[model samples]
Target: EDQVTQSPEALRLQEGESSSLNCSYTVSGLRGLFWYRQDPGKGPEFLFTLYSAGEEKEKERLKATLTKKESFLHITAPKPEDSATYLCAGREKGGGNKLTFGTGTQLKVEL
Candidate 1:
């Protein structure tokens, strides 16, 4: 079974504060690591796709990195608009596009 777990179910950040959230995963075989940002009552917005260990991607105020067994989403100098639920999903070998997602880490940035 492919499983994903995220730490700090919720996070509170002040404006300009930076931090990194962890996503731990277990899978039969890794196909891809996906990072998504979801707002309240909305679908997730794709952030990055990591296919192998040591892979990384960045955008705006976020950077995502993948390793053999885990991934990290680093938020830099976040603003109130950066607040959202960060979700991690893994596509296992032969699993197709069906992603197994973590519960997610909800982030709240206060000005």
Candidate 2:
């Protein structure tokens, strides 16, 4: 069973609009939490990997943070280029490199 869950299955935003995406997980002994951006017809691009509660990573207008139970992807002043499906995954401790992924949240940014 999948241990990761993403909310709002879909999202729409106007250019320069900011929003946050949610990713809740139920993995036992989580080793790491990952965030990715997937464009149409392309594989997911890794954004961040948070390993502990309170950890955060940022690139450009995107920021990712992790907590004990969930992680969040915050988009600040997002542009249309940021439109894509956001995905989250968790690696189980001692479960090798296998990861459980959430279905992803589709995001659309309009002008």
Which consecutive 10 residues in model 1 have the weakest lDDT in total? Answer: 90-99
Candidate 1 C-alpha lDDT tens digits along 6-104:
998999999999999999999778789999999999999999999989988999999999999999999999999999999999887773467889999
lDDT for model 1: 0.93
- Report clashes for each candidate as comma-separated counts: 0, 0
TM-scores for every candidate against the unseen true structure:
0.96, 0.96
- Consecutive 10-residue window with the lowest summed lDDT within model 2: 91-100
- Alpha-carbon runs more than 4 Å astray in model 1: none
Error of 2 at 69 (Å): 0.5
- C-alpha local distance difference test of each model: 0.93, 0.95
Tens-digit per-residue lDDT, 1-110, candidate 2: 54999988999999999999999999988889999999999999999999999999999999999999999999999999999999999998774688999999999999
